[model samples]
Every structure is written in C-alpha cells, then in structure tokens.
Target: MRIRATVAAVSAALALSAFAVPAAHAAGSTLDVTFSSMKVNSGKAITVGATSTVKVKATYTLTHPSGVSVANVLSGPVLYRGTSAKDADTQVVSDAPGTCTTVSSTTLHCSATITLPASDLYNADAGTWKQGGVAVDAKSGVQKWQNDLGTIPVRRAAKLTADATPEPVKKGGTITVTGKLTRANWETGKYAGYATQPVKLQFRKKGSSTFTTVKTIKSSSTGALKTTVTASADGDFRYSFAGTSTTSAVSSAADFVDVQ
Candidate 1:
C-alpha cells in the first residue's frame, strides 16, 4: 500500500478559475470512479470447490465533472454490500490508507482488499470511500482509482449439510427448508465471481415410500433458499439437496393441524 501525498494537479487555468471565483469552493466537482477488474486475483479465476487465496484488485480511474482535474487521496473503512442478511456481510477490506500516486500530474492510482473467508462468496461495489474527518457530503470530491473486482466464487468442499427452518414444521400445516447451494466462487462473468448454487427441494408425504421433487430453486445472491411442504399422513419425511450429496430428516409426528 503506497501512501504518498502528491501536489494538487488541477490545471493552471482551473486553479486560476478556482482562485478567481469563490463559488468554485461550493460547486465541488464530482469525482467519478470506474473499475478495471473486480477479481480476487489480478488475472486468474478460482475454480469451484477450491479455496481462493488471491487478493482482489480494482483499477480505478477518477475524472472530474467539470473536466478541470484535481488530484486527491482516498482511504478508510470500505463496506461491500451483499444480500440483506446480517451475517452475509463480506468484508472485502478492513482499513488501510493510501494516497493518490499520479500517473501524470492529473491522474492517480491506489488499491485495497480485506481478507475473505474460505466458505464465504465475494462481490463488491465501487463507491465513495468515507474518510473519518471529512463530512459525508464532502467525501464525494475524492475518488479512489478502481479496478474491476475479480470474485473468487468458492465451492463448498464435498460434504453433507442440511438447512431447514423450525427444525420440523407443524403437521397439517407446512414445513420449510431454508436451503442453499454454496460453492467457492466459480465460473466467470458477473454472478460467477460469487458462489451461490441453485437449491433443490425434495419432499414426500408423511409415511410415503418415496420422496418426490417438490421444487428446485437457487439461493439469493446471499445464498438463501427456502421451501414449504404440507404433510398428507402423519409420520416422517425424507428429503435432500440435489446435485451435491446432502440430506435432512424431519418428523411430523403430530397427527392434526393447528388452525391458529
């Protein structure tokens, strides 16, 4: 991480104009940030079911709204937004401060990434970095050069896992399976950078001999899938996630439905 301060790089004409006109102070120009690669590694992609150890790189280029360029530094806590779940938060980066290293007098570059978990998927957005001391509104003036982030969609190691809500649902009503197809970030393109396997939901009526396919669905970007089933006979139902080898067992021992 390079943190060196560069001289203000706005053009002489712009600087003169900024100095000549007091309103220029209030009319803060927009620093638009664009990315090159939002990947875990610079050029490589992590295969499904494998752990990713690459640091994500984002090549960012900043431009002013007025076209009169000025150089500025950006840093601080960067939050990567994922599906709405609380634990779904993937911290792409924690905290590291890097200043702008200008390519020319007018251009600059910088990068940062937070450690990612092995089972967790990765995806993030390029937004204005919030500097602690700077007011929220004023922070927009600073732009961190962005790289198109590379994602390491990690596949879960082959194993047996079960996901269900309420453990076993009430009989005569419904049972729900909160399923997820989790893998390491695999594939390519937009959604490929993250791991969210399409979920499979199978069920059989209570005491039924064979389990039947009730529904198949994919987890949200955050890896969440759910299914609800009603029991025909009071007993036990057997079902499992399709594709990968996984299963869940629930006993609907209660014979009657609870109308409430």
Candidate 2:
C-alpha cells in the first residue's frame, strides 16, 4: 500500500480542486495536520433527494505550534457551483459538520452525513466536487492544517425498466421483451427517456446462479425497448445500461418467463 505524504501534490487519486486553504493569520501557521484512511461512502454514487447520506469519513494527526492543543475540525464535501472559484456559489454540501474524535495526541477521526433535497444538488451545474478536512486552534479559531480528502463524481440519475411478454410460451416459440431507459432532468424536475443508447439483454436460468449476456440492443428514439428471443427454458430476463460519463448505470428487475 502506497502511503500518500504528498505535502505539495495536493490532489490525490480522488481529485480535489485547488485548496481554497482558508488564510491563517497566526504566527508561522497555527497548526499542521495530516489526514489518512479517508473513506467516502466507499466512493459510491450520490443522487439528489437521497436521505441519510453519510458522505465522508477520515482519520487525522495534528501538530500544533508551541503546545496549543488542537480544537475542532471542519470537514465535508465542498461544492463550487461552476467550473471555477469565481462561480457565484460555494459551500459545504451537507447540513452536518465533519464531526471529529480524538484518539491520541496526534491522531483523530471525523465523519459527516447529509440528506440533500433536490434543491441542494439537482440544479447545480455538472462538475467535480471535493471532500476535505481542516484544523482549528483550541484557543483561537484560525483554520489551518487543511487536507483534501478526495472527490465524488456528480452525475444524473438513470433508471431501467423492463418486461418480458408471453409469459408462458411453447418451448420453441418466440417471447418478446420490452423496456425503457430514462434519466433525471434537473430543469424539468422529471425523468425523461434517453434515446439511441446501447443496452444489454441478460438472462439467467431459474435455478442457475449466473447471468449471461444474450444480446446488445439499442433504445429507440423514444427510449423504447423491443426485442424478441426464442424461448428454450424457464428463466429470468433483464436489461442493463452500461451508463455514460454524464449518467449513472442501472439494471431492470428480473422478469420471469415460463416455458411450456
């Protein structure tokens, strides 16, 4: 495991923006902090209107000037509304603080959870968001020893719904499968069909544990799913969307077919 001690290379694999490092007016910097074991929802996908979201957790070690024990740490996902700091909006993404716990003289940990309603993220421009930590002096509150936790990609939510028709069919007969692919539209506050996208048809025998790809199909102009397969055995069929850079992936529920 590579231990990251890059004091200069502020950006880690998770990709945080240039440190806004709140200015510290103290003498020779108030404190020095190092953060590690940073975990952000296991780097999971975040969606709008999602509740009870525990976005980030991290451990820290601190060094203070002339024996001033550290105070609190403020950390969480910080969002810059646009592509740059000049954007009109900037702030932490959660309502909760990056609550911290001290385990030793130089070791501590922190975490934050948020339930952002649609207004918090759905309307924001698509771009990179950051997670980070900051140290404050116990006596004075000058922020310092800040470290960037990482980043979590923000993408539009997508959904896949499917159905296989002619449920009980002759063993050698044809069964039609249909489905649709849709994605969140922030402006309209609705989910709309995504057209001309590649989706895969997958199947698993009712008793088998594996699902094999049957074929790749494309959605129609209206994001409609229409495909036919020759029935051979009782099994479950589903559709999966591989997803694009601007959207999240999704898979439809299994639709079982009874072969007579």
Candidate 3:
C-alpha cells in the first residue's frame, strides 16, 4: 500500500517485459548492472512504533558495463517477504532513486531511503525480511532484480512498566509488585496490551549494578502483572520481557523500595 512513483512505474514495466531475465543473458543490455555490498538500516533491526512512518537508509555498490549510460537508470534497495519481488507477498521500496557517486569507471556507490508506514503493515509482517536490489532503465523499460542479498529483522516497538507498593516496609513483610506489557498496534495506531506473555520479575540490590531474576510470571488477559514478594532488603524491582519475533525486547524502569 506504500508504493511510490519509482516502484510503481518500474514494476509496471517489468511486468509487461518479463524482467526476470538472468544476469548471464544481459550481454548487450542495460540489465548487466550488478549490485554489491548492499546494506539496509545500517544492518540493524528496524523497530516501528504506532502511528509513525519509519524511514531507513540503504546503501550499496552498483557495477555496470562502461558502455551503458547510468543516467537513464533507476536503482535502489528493497525489502520483501517472499521468494522474489514479482512474487512478494509484501515489499518496501524506496520513494526515489538512489543518489550515486562515481567510484570508478565501471562502479558507483549509492544510497536511498525506504519508507514504511505503520498503518500499512500487519503483525505477521514483523520478522526476517529478505533484502534485494532493483534497477530499471527508465527509457528502455528493461529491468534487473537481485534477490537474497541479505536479511533484516522488522519488529514492533514494545513497552513495559513496574511498580512496587509500600516504599518502606518492614523486613519479612509482604510486598506487591504490579506492571503492564504493551506493544505497538499498527492497525489501530496505538499501544495495546500483549496478553498472555511471560514476563520476568527482577531485583537489584542498592549497591549492586546487576539485576537478578526473582520469578517469571505470565501477564493477565489484559497484559497486567501482579505478584507478591517478601521484603528482605533494600533494593529495586523491575520487569523484563524477552520479546517475540514480532515485538522488540523491553524492560521497565526500576522502582526502589526500602526495608526497615
């Protein structure tokens, strides 16, 4: 649904001309252009929050025969969720052609931005996505696609909170810890409860820097968490989520408690 002008124009031409021709058959054609050193989002996971459009930068090296004039060529990187671009279930393409700088007589380094709108994405779309490159001759209508250049993880942003009751409690007394787990909902453009997920209760001593897991508990149907712990010492309590393929890992800020 986030298709851009360059992608739409090139895709239409490729469809009509059957642009899947292999590189070996591009002897005298503009399809001889090849892509290398392709990288998306600087090789980091792309995390999207509700309602915001995420733009990631992609860079690659393009090599072409000296005889081919690249002035008429449109090239950029794309992320897809299927075997190939033409057969992709969903794909994200750059809004414009890549800006290239000459590296040599036969090679150029290029970079472009791929925009992703949260409203256009589904929960199932969060996972490993294949990276590929596409090049099209604007005038000749010839195109070339290189699939499986690499992979990137696309995940929804997650959030967690923790609060411990009775800031100052007597030793051996019972303390209640409560929190919530939520994740970005692309469809509704909001942060919704992530129900029935396992979350960890962690404790860190006043003088220590490390937090040790005290227990693991599952969230309620509405993503609420509540547990009881014995107040033994002065420390901080927090919750942690390991995260799923569709969500990014997150931890809550620690709530400090004093034992009398």
Candidate 4:
C-alpha cells in the first residue's frame, strides 16, 4: 500500500506541473525621450557667432513588452528648423549618445547627446520660419523599437511662429508679444558647444521711432528660449537683438502684423 501511494503522488505532481502556465515576461511599453533644457540666440539661431558653444542633453527611457534585447544604439541627429517647410530645409543637428541600462526586468534607461555645428547656428538662412521642430533619419537596420502608446513620437516642437490666422487687436491697442530664444553652438571656433552669453530682445515700431521693452526669453534644456510682451500702440512691429560681449551676437529682425 505504501509503495502504491508514493507512485500515485509522484504522478499527480508531474501532471500538475505540466498543466501550469509559464510566467510572462515583465517588459514595459516603448521608449520615452525628453529634453531638460535647450537654448539659442534671441533672434539668430546660434549665439557667440561661429565660435559659440551650445550644450544639449536628453534622457531616454526604454520600456519593453517581453524578453527582447534592444540594440545599444542611439537616436539620430535632429535639426533645429523653421516652421514653414520640411525635408532638405531641415538641417542635421547634433545628438548625444544612447545606451541602455537595465532599470528593471521590464524597464531600461538611456541617454542622447547633441552638438550643433558652428556656422549653421549663427546666421539666418533667409527663409520664412513658419514653424520650428526636430527631425531624424531612419535607423540603419530594421526598426526593433515600436511606440506602445504615444511615448515615442519622432520629434518635439522646439520653437514655432505665430499662426497665419491673425488675432484681433484694436488699433493702437496694448497687446502682449512673446517668444523663446536659443543660442547656437560652435562649428569651428575657440569655444565650441559651450553657451554664449544670453541675448536681449528689443522691440520697436517698423516705421516709427517709438520703442518698448518686452520680456526676455532664454533657452531650454534642449537649448531654446521663449518670451512674451505687450505693445503700447498698434502699427507695423519688429524686434532686434544685438550681441553683447558677454551675450549672443546680433540677430536678424523678426516681424509681426499688428491689427486694429
């Protein structure tokens, strides 16, 4: 009787083990990349002229769904472009390194770095900046990473121009104007990738002598700045930012339509 009972117990234990489901992998969703700050000149793209330095840093968090190994590769070089057009108009900007560190069985951590070229950040390309955003090239190999929710969108809005639809304003009305500023990094200069001094924006009437001081804008963790101000009266308006020895170099005039 003892021998028979032992055999039946062993058989029942084996059967239960075979029927049980395997454990699921603890992978999370897609990767999440974000910038802490970014900056450029108030009017121009880069500060400190061609010799200026711009520092940019981003944090990347990778989430997985299963037990898949992600290749230790970084994101591509993104551009700081105007709002109007895309493609070739989009210049290739610098990026930081990307690496994966196992935060948990289902979570991973990584980073990206970018260094802007010298001349590209200094002068205006003589193009209408309708909008401003970032872009990147397709990864060299087949894409392994996919967006789980909406966490892994390709680009973020760095800066943007006012919309085509004009906002209503009373003639000679007091209205607020705001914008962000980002100084450029160096391509071929003494101080490269280091931030130039901050730039100051001065507002004025297009054809009039009257000028009013508006708020100053600075860069973000990604190297961009935004500012806003109110107008004393309505007319053709524009802004100018000249470089100080400690601040960014001169920037081209930016304009806005003031309506009655």
lDDT of each: 0.34, 0.60, 0.84, 0.34
Evaluated against the true structure, the overall lDDT of model 1 is 0.34
Question: Over the full model, what C-alpha lDDT does candidate 4 score relative to the true structure?
Answer: 0.34
Q: Which structure is stronger by TM-score: 1 or 2?
A: 2
CA shift of 216, model 1, Å: 25
For candidate 1, lDDT tens digit of each residue in 114-141? Answer: 3333334422212222111100113334
**Who wins the lDDT comparison?**
3
**Pairs with steric clashes in candidate 3:** none
Candidate 3, overall lDDT? 0.84
Question: All candidates' TM-scores?
Answer: 0.29, 0.72, 0.86, 0.32
Off by over 4 Å in 3: 2-30
In angstroms, how far off is 235's CA in candidate 2?
A: 1.2
Per-residue lDDT over 149-196 for candidate 4, one digit per residue giving the tens place of the 0 to 100 score: 111111111122221113456555445443333333232333222123
What local lDDT score does residue 163 receive in model 4, on the 0 to 100 scale? 19
TM accuracy, model 2: 0.72
Candidate achieving the largest TM-score: 3
Could you tell me how far off, in angstroms, the CA of residue 53 lies in candidate 4 after the best superposition? 3.4
Task: Score residue 42 of candidate 4 by CA lDDT.
Answer: 22
RMSD of 2: 8.0
Scored against the true structure, residue 137 in model 1 reaches a CA lDDT of 17
Going through the candidates in the order shown, the clash numbers are 27, 0, 0, 52
Between the candidate structures 1 and 3, which one is better when assessed by lDDT?
3
Local accuracy of candidate 3 as per-residue lDDT tens digits, 93-174? 7666788999788999999888788987887788999998888776666677789889999999999999998989999999
Give, for candidate 1, the lowest lDDT window spanning 10 residues: 2-11
